[model samples]
Target: MALTYLRHQLHLHRHKIIGFFLLALLSSGQQTLAQGKLKGENLPGYEHKRLRWGFSLGVNASWYQLEHSELYVEAIKSNPDFSVNEKTGIGFNVNFISSYRLSPDFVLRAQPGVGYHSRAIEYKGMPADDDNGIAGGDVTQEMNTFAGELPLLVKYESKRRKNSQMYFIAGVKPSLVVGGQKKGSEYLQVKSLDFAVEYGVGLDMFYPFFKFAPEIRYSRGISNIHKPSPGMFNNSIQQLNTNTITLYLNFE
Candidate 1:
């Protein structure tokens, strides 16, 4: 059920998401073309540096990848229309970046950051006498959290063209829930630790003083973050994984 729902959601929005990324990529290319042609190579030696530091600010949209439990059938029998859904939410992140140059085309990067997020789990068709007893028909519970994220990544870059370059990044990110309700009687509990795979593409625009990059990244949770708790909403779900899409503005 989780996989099916995820596929359906992706199918519905894949075109819009793809187009948005392509448009952004095209706009960046155009801007680079307009300026790079008139400017001599800027920061010619910047890429050769053994180590560099920078930071990133980003905005994100986050949701959950949900899976039904074995008790889902029991839930359905109790409430014929019972279903669980997730709502996407907006979030933001700030990262202090440190990178090491491995070769002309490859770099190793570590981004340690804090992220703030608020997402929700929605339950529909709950019986009136449901567990946690709040005259339940449809219940939406919000999960707000602050996470400390550490991402170790490998960046592969294209050959520099004048003052612009394109790159792809892939890595692993491990996160700890620094602030949030870990467990409760009224809300679905979530585990404090999570691990995810990260991948993204970006354009690096070189200026006289700094390198500016616009990046679009996606993170897919590999660990099930669900923690059992005392609620029908929690009991109906067996797995909860995270999904996040972020657009980052980077400076180095």
Candidate 2:
């Protein structure tokens, strides 16, 4: 009898329960839509400024792209163990940004900055030496550099979606070595000037006071930066190009 009574109660309240759930779902969806619309309205017309200024802090991982000389290739035929290995190095940078709005979807930017970088190349199966840390018949050459960077880029932006917009940037950067190489011990040498092409993608977040962006960029050098020296390790490399990946946090 209690089961029959329970069944009758469920049948009578089923339509009311369904209505309650439907109302709750509709209310939740409407609230979500309203919040999204509100978010989309943030920083309206922020991109219409003729000029803007900002700054960025970044961390970078850098490595060398190397081409072996013909002499080195011939040497490798006789000694297969003769090899050079590039090790990735990490560094930091800071940039002051200047931007000009060309259109709603496009902007021009220039960033001038300074960075400190370290990179290493390992020579395997080298002659054992007591003086230069090659006691085990291998030597690692580490280069630490401080450089000034100037980059000019074009940025293309997507339509804003809820408080954030996506963008793509492509540019060229020219750098000059400011410091960080000590004179003496001559295993490897690098030129003072380097130029690279850079490309990246970022998301611009709108805030009440300012804008913020987090970006990831790739850089590739078009010219060889290696300077030839009178050393086996230096002569073995025909070309050395720069390759770096950087993650940046920007504020405007």
Candidate 3:
């Protein structure tokens, strides 16, 4: 039952991601078309400077990778029919950007910020969706990871067209969890440190005063955040992977 709900939500969010990409595409296409008629630059002499600073605000959806153990399969055989499902959590992103111009086509950037990340994996055997603790309707165990994130990225931009340009970025992000909470009765102990490689694309629009970049990116976790524990709940999951998709609005 939880798996079905999660699939529906995934379908919905997939469309949202597509919507962002389409908007960026349309906006870029118009700007590119306008360049054929207009000769002047959109924001004259915007990237000539050697150094720039800005900040970014964004929203993200977080996911998890759940692998069932042998014990999990055996336990399911012994107990009543049950299955595990994962849900993506809605979160926010805030970053301070410091960038350096390596050339007309390349820039080095560091985006350091705090992110609110959350995910819930439910054991489907509950009565009510409310926090009665995984007993019968759709009871989920929620885990929160409040961490400080530092991402070092290299951004590559295409040639400017009517002050609008497209760019791609790739980097490594390392984080340390500052705090976290188990919101319900169930507790899952996750590690405090995480590291991942990040990559994405963005559309850069030049305004008279500032540059705005609407970007989307994905980050995958290489860490297995689970520890050895002697319970059906903890023993069920063999590996846990982190996944995040974020859409950022950056102003410089």
lDDT tens digits by residue: candidate 3, 48-165: 6689999999877787888888877876786556677677676778999999999989999999999988677877752222342433444566766678999999999898777787
Reference-based lDDT, each prediction: 0.84, 0.77, 0.75
Question: Model 2, 1-252: lDDT tens per residue?
Answer: 332244335552323433443454345445544656776466778877889999999877677889988877887788788888776666778999999999889999999999877777889986444554334357778777889999899999998776677789999999998997655335678888999999988777777788877777788999899887655667688899998777777888
Candidate 2 error regions (>4 Å): 1-40, 128-136
Give the distance in Å from residue 102's predicted Cα in candidate 2 to where it truly belongs.
1.3
- As a whole number from 0 to 100, the lDDT of residue 85 in candidate 1 is 88
- Clash totals, every prediction: 0, 0, 7
Query: Against the hidden reference, what TM-scores do the models get?
Result: 0.89, 0.80, 0.81
Best by lDDT: 1
What is the per-residue lDDT of model 1 for residues 59-151, given as tens digits with 9 covering 90 to 100? 776788899888877778866798888876667899999999998889999999999766778888866545576577888877778999999
Candidate RMSDs in Å, in order, are: 5.1, 17.8, 4.9
What ranking emerges by lDDT with the best candidate at the front? 1, 2, 3
Top-scoring candidate (TM-score): 1
